[model samples]
Target: MKKISQKNDKMTTVSLTQILENGIWQMEAEFSNSQYYAAIGIVRDTYNIPADTHPGLDPHCHHMVSYGMSGYQWGDGAVNYKGNRTEGNIAYKDNQIIKAEYDSEKGTVIFSVDGVQQPVYVRGINEKVRFIIYMCYSQASCTIRSLKKLIAPTTKHVANEIAVQW
Candidate 1:
């Protein structure tokens, strides 16, 4: 497994090499000893954001979705965009698993803590995107547990009909 570390005083952002366009993709991450915030989300593959910049804070990249410490979710250059909030004001704890799932077909991205899905989600994303993470303080580190494409569930569409009286 490859590890990325930031031992400096400046904030840093990192992205995965895989590009996700269609179908559902999920990434699970665990943060340790982080200060300020450790953020995880997805960004457009074509965006040219600086390594020291936070993708959620970039006005040019408004489709990004990120969840960080203190139950904060940032997307479309706005904090808690659309009033989405985490349950119980959760904060980043050691070895706490945070999962981010993106469904391209639905043009939405949602985050979950451990296994419970959060209430907030971002929508209207139509571009190919890559998974990204941000570290805001020195000695902060993250472990990407898994990144994989999920099998799309097959469902049959059924039409509802109402009986009409003559």
Candidate 2:
């Protein structure tokens, strides 16, 4: 696999497969935009990682996130997809999925994003997905340690027990 160290908060790097998949969806599928992202699905049904179980990895761990299972169309588009702009080859921005709900009576799915659940109707579905989990450090040292442990077979995917943000 490839790697890009010396990362930053906003400097989000996506997987190679993700980039390629996004390209295909943008061209073939009637998606809102040329890209999509699915990150919040990291925990699946859980709300957040519990504080007690969070522990430090072995001396050799390396990497922040463990592997995950996800199916596309992931990610909120980097732009605002207003309406059926994808029709007639028009363009709508890819948006994020803050929340998803099923409407019983209306027989429609609603997207709760940024704070509102808006209804959307898409023509097709793109199901290229992957899974991701966390192996993290709140600081650079923790990240470094985690990366080191990843090289060792005996080590496992674990986060720093403490959540310190400074």
lDDT scores in order:
0.64, 0.21
Which digits, one per residue and each the tens of the lDDT, describe model 2 over residues 1-166? Answer: 2222322222122222221112111101111221222121111111223432111122111111111112212112211122111111112233322332212222222223434322332212223322122212222111111111112122122332211110
Clashes of each: 0, 25
lDDT of 1 at 42: 77
Per-residue error for 33 in candidate 2, Å, reads 22
Q: Give the per-residue lDDT of model 1 (tens digit) for 55-95.
A: 44646236455667752234222223223333332455557
Residue 40 CA error for candidate 1 (Å)? 0.6
Give the top-scoring candidate (TM-score). 1
* Highest lDDT scorer: 1
lDDT, residue 29, model 2:
12
Candidate 2 versus the native: TM-score?
0.21
